[model samples]
Target: MTAADFAGTKTALALASSDVTMREAFVETVTAAMDTDPRIAVVTADISAGNFAEARSRHPERVVNVGIREQAMIGVAGGMALTGLRPVAHSYAPFLIERPFEQIKLDLGHQDVGAVLVSIGASYDDPVWGRTHQAPGDVALIDTLPGWTIHVPGHQDEVRALLSTALAGDDRVYLRLSTRRNSRAHSVEGFTAVRTGSKGVVVAVGPMLDSVLAATSTVDVTVLYAATVRPFDHAGLRAAVGSNANVVLVEPYLRGTSAHKVATALADVPHRLLALGVGREEEVRAYGTAEQHDVVHGLDTAGLHHSITHFLG
Candidate 1:
């Protein structure tokens, strides 16, 4: 008898893997969260038809298309939270976080209501759209908001995990997302050792962890993937570094990300923390596809390998 065919089973697994895009994963997560809680709603800027177009069309009644008013969208989302409704808003990183920051800080966060702010297509997803749209520093501003929980999922798996966790959370969450599929942070229910660097470590957040994980085999290195940025897991971090650990933080956001905060918390270790990210002055030339941007920021695997070798060697 001929060997039983396994092509059909393999194909279904392959298709299942391919069908889960980051945006779709987020939409499904949000939809389920909203379904479990009727008070949940979504708001979007004019970009609803662009980045969130599919989700908007998919969940029309639950999503509020706030048009081009970035600030207004955030303000209204904060208002919704007052009535005990969970409002999640999506927009370009810079516009959503920067334009409506006051509302986030004073309205939703200060008032202690559950409001979710999602910023998509961050850190150089599109070059044609140019400088104004690509936001590497988007998460930093929200990171400044004292009660805000900021999450940057560096891999597809982490994107789904973080989104689900955040949607189920009761506090204010700022989710900065990258549309590029390749770097999805490997999602674990909590945190795990993605890679290990012998001489030192790259404690990373967002999708930059992907390149770090890949680069580790080339060089002797270790990477602790920080899927949840705000309200850090200090216990996990302590366990990651048993005694002596020299580290660097890799994040897609600006220098002041959770990586920075985590590094600061490790002052007693006498370890060096190298911050790998883009800042304001450097934002001008920081425009391109995800790969192009990561390469520019020294964020790709080659760059991660080089950084590991340069620092350790």
Candidate 2:
């Protein structure tokens, strides 16, 4: 199977509209969940609170707005979790994960509580806001802690499905939402094989799938799509690699965020891995659009094609 193989599939046409973003889908899915599931509560740091006006009106106690204090937002979610409420924390990526990281590490992780941390402004999604609003290292930072189910949905439909699953469980989950999306959503049961070839294996994380597909369209390599990244699909990846252990991981977060997992998964098998994503070598001083930043980080289609081809060679 290859990129062409996905053409006209039912899943591809289900929600192919580019208008429905992952964040919007999250708000819709979560807000609806609040109606049925009394345990589903939301904690926000003044981000997207207006979008939840109806939910807040219906369930005042469940919907909390912690002003601009990101720390307090996490603290509130932790408190709610302690009281057996499934808290969903929302904010920009930097504020949600980076700003009050200590509170997350201690208030939630140390307290052994569970909450759904939903974030928008993925990496440099709003690069015009500058680096302060960006958080490419969010996933990498959260990886340091244990017992987190990190979800990076590539499409709005996937977001709805992943968020629904997270809400159904009492576990720590980081649902990273973004403006970036693919043309369609995959069923996403672990690392799904989108394309198969004998040259090498490329694992596309979340929104990176479209770019990865285009980059490897001509190359004789297998492409795997991963929406649920944390519980890094070790078995799926190992199976994909089979004998040809040349692997390339294309993540939307910080470069090499899941490189260690890949390394560990293929520990016994001889493999050459190329980890591509937002580069950490230098700070992107210039403020520009997210697409421009993608070029800077070599995450754009051309950049990905160049790097992937070089690695496959």
Candidate 3:
């Protein structure tokens, strides 16, 4: 449960070339979908130009740019939704979620209308951008409003599946994309089992699977992989945990956001739970690569292994 336990481990590893980034897959999938469905409109706060260039060129009228105004971006999306158009809004994590919290609450939540709120910065995606652009609380904030289905896809394949599914629905959907990703792509929905153990269970949400695997490789615990956290697979979790009430949740967002659901699922059973994720106690303020931020926040394999080992004991 200490640094010595992870002594010779290579914590930071790269993905294969075949793997597609979540951002790339989402833009490509959505743009292609626009040709068949004219009801799909894209609204951006000026951050996703690289991905939207093709969509902008082909369907200029369908794409709306609200400059750098995050609030206006949501407002515009809400308006379009009312007119029978399904709007997909995009921006940095904080600018999209925190800056326009009220707009999302009033324009989207209050009106009972919905938009596909997609974002790139998952917590500290841009450690170089510092705290202003980071949003570890986006999911927690979204949980404030009821009926929002949140998708935290770990790979490009999952992104494509979730985006297609969300676009077809009329309810509020938040697709959280991150620079942090898993080594491989998982199935579209539900929890996938990576390993099994009898002592307890560990649930790795989206991009957290790789690190969770590295952390629990030697530990005796069932590992469950989830690409969709909200609308949390309560049944899947309860089934995986079975008689073992000891559970560990590793997510890429604010810690303990789904703690309540886990508790609710195991309410009748006596349980002890540990929640690991990005810390919200203080600002990171460090300027470096995203990996460095992972180290500081204990999301890396070494850190995660250390935490899990201690928690299980």
Candidate 4:
């Protein structure tokens, strides 16, 4: 795919109705699936459980609320998985992945169980809630464990599709949802090409696609959109890089989260990679909107443009 392929489509799609959020879509998709699929179960830690009222009413035994206990939530989900149930756990990013990481590593990874772990409040989605709500290292931490599928959907449509795909299989999957979204959802198989250029390739993960497109609008570089980051698409990236091999990875999570994967992907090919994302050097204690945080972390359009142009040069 190239810029010409999506010319004028994104702007038009952005104007269309977008009242449905990723969380709502998750609830709807999982609830409808529960009506027919008895193996599917939803486990929540007092977050987003109200949205599943109808589903819980119908299948009380399956839809469980473990209250504010995130660790126990994972434990319960793991228990359910042991009993042949497909558990889908939900909570904020920090509470879901960061808080109960030991449980995840032990209860799921150690036990060799499969569950669909869903999270909201991506990074600093609700900045007013402060660092406790922010989890820029979620994906990076999950990477430490083995056999986990990570899906960071850029739009509600993508969310529905990816969630369905995860629910269909009994794999240890992590679906990262965010309030930020792209204007449109691309048919992402693996690092889907949105624009082709010769100077280099700019890999945009999840919600970073739109900003990436804006940043490299005039640059001669290929832009790749990755809704699924884990099991990094080595083949697609290798093909995109061709010979130039100058790559810029623009992720919404911690900086260099996918740098190792990119390095491994292009290990044989000599390449220069510039990893851009939330900074870990220092924590910003100020309360601001997510966009402000983006600017602070050099993830805004301007920040991305500056970094891309400098790296390309």
lDDT for each residue of candidate 1 in 1-313, tens digit (9 for 90 to 100): 2334577777787677666766666766776666566777888877754545454565666678777888788888888888777788887787887777787777777787887887777766776688777676676676676777777776556666776766766788887777654433365434568765466767777666666777777766667877677777666666666665766777776754666566656766766666677654545564446677667767788887787678777
Off by over 4 Å in 2: 1-18
Which candidate has the highest lDDT of all?
4
Worst 10 residues of 3 by lDDT: 8-17
TM-score of 1: 0.86
List ranges where model 1 is wrong by over 4 Å: 1-14, 49-61, 181-185, 188-190, 279-281, 286-288
Output the better candidate (2/4) by lDDT: 4
Give the C-alpha lDDT of model 3. Answer: 0.87
Off by over 4 Å in 3: 1-19
Clashes in predicted model 1 = 13
Candidate 2 yields a Cα-based lDDT of 0.92
Q: Against the unseen true structure, what C-alpha lDDT does each candidate score?
A: 0.70, 0.92, 0.87, 0.94
Give lDDT tens digits, candidate 4, residues 135-247.
Answer: 99999999999999999999999998999889989899999999999988887579899999999999999999999999999999999999999889999999999898999
Q: TM-score for all predictions? A: 0.86, 0.94, 0.92, 0.95
Task: Please give the lDDT score at residue 137 for candidate 1.
Answer: 64
Ranking by TM-score: 4, 2, 3, 1
Q: Tell me the tens digit of each residue's lDDT in model 3 across 1-313.
A: 5786555342422233335678888888899999888889999988985678888898899998889898999999999999989999999889999999999999999999978999998888887777898899999999989889999988887888899989888999999998778777887567888899998899999889998898888999999998887788888888988888889999888988899989988988889999998887887787898888888889899999898889878
At residue 195, give the lDDT of candidate 2. Answer: 93
Of the candidates numbered 1 and 4, which has the greater lDDT value? 4
In model 3, the number of clashes is 0
